[model samples]
Target: MNTMTVTKSVVMITEEASFRIKEMMEHNEEQDAFLRISVNGGGCSGLSYGMTFDQNSQENDVLDEQFGIAIIVDKEDAAILEGTKVDYKQSLMGGGFTIDNPNAIASCGCGTSFKAAARPAEEQPCE
Candidate 1:
């Protein structure tokens, strides 16, 4: 047996979110797809997290897999998303992917956008 140990990364996916994503993908029946987690300008906070499916990924996109799901984040956004957990909660109010980011210095109460430790201007670098 090979002695090299695999170093697993820590991208968090809450149980509810996993179930929801799986159901959505299976229901949609689109094989050429992935969950795109990203950050873009505009929100109650200085910046905001963007989640979508089946757009396009730049060549530099960082690919990750966790909990039987594929994740795609831009090379730059990877820094901001590190150590972050994506979760979904069906609270009576609503439900969505919650970012549990250790890097966030401040986050909006709506749980959408956040300011990183460096607080870079709302300018998302051009691809």
Candidate 2:
């Protein structure tokens, strides 16, 4: 896909979050790596969000740019992640990145896990 087409899509990355991501990239000497975002199963909430630095993009990936960073997301994951925003916050305890996903119906107390409407809860057999 063309850069212009990818740039038109919306995926927000706050300035503070961008700074931290860039810092990590610099620390690892991965200047050419892009931020890869994905959603996987097996969290307490049935799904979890994962972020990592990847040097390659798959053919089915949806590439976008935000705050000067290349963000790649799987085509399947993109549908559930639309209108998501990521930010970094510093508190008395420490600083960490936070993800706010509008499409989430539920989230675990730990904050890294979430439940989306697309993945309905399955009934477990009685013990």
Candidate 3:
């Protein structure tokens, strides 16, 4: 049986985001690479989204597939990333992969750090 399956709270990948990811993988100087998402404690607001191409995945990493792309998220961070969509929007000014996270109660203008609504009250500490 297939143990891994995409859930309704999957991280969607847009065509533009797929193209960019594919390009990054193709030109990757490293032999093994995978996209990783994690929550860090440093942003204009509070938490920040960390994205990087990794060569290894921890045993507790949550594996997800979208648009033929493999995504890795640590178990501890999965809750905050689920239901998030990675999309690319282009305009005359600029464009890049934008992460839309339903779990985020509020995100700064940079869209990097976010405060998850479900986080422990003590962790957020009322702001």
User: Which candidate comes out best when scored by lDDT?
Assistant: 2
Candidate 2 achieves a global lDDT of 0.80
Please give the TM-score that candidate 2 achieves against the real structure: 0.86
Candidate 3 per-residue lDDT over residues 59-126, each given as its tens digit: 77777777776777888888888778888888999878888888989776655567876663223322
lDDT of 1 by residue, 52-118 (tens): 7754556667776666766777768777878888888788897766678898888767666668865
Off by over 4 Å in 2: 1-7, 121-127
Shift in Å, residue 51, candidate 3: 1.1
Give stretches of model 1 more than 4 Å off: 1-10, 122-127
- Order the candidate numbers by TM-score, best to worst: 2, 3, 1
- Give the top-scoring candidate (TM-score): 2
Error of 2 at 7 (Å): 4.4
- Candidate 3, RMSD to the unseen true structure: 4.5
List ranges where model 3 is wrong by over 4 Å.
1-9, 120-127
Per-candidate Cα lDDT values, in order, are: 0.69, 0.80, 0.72
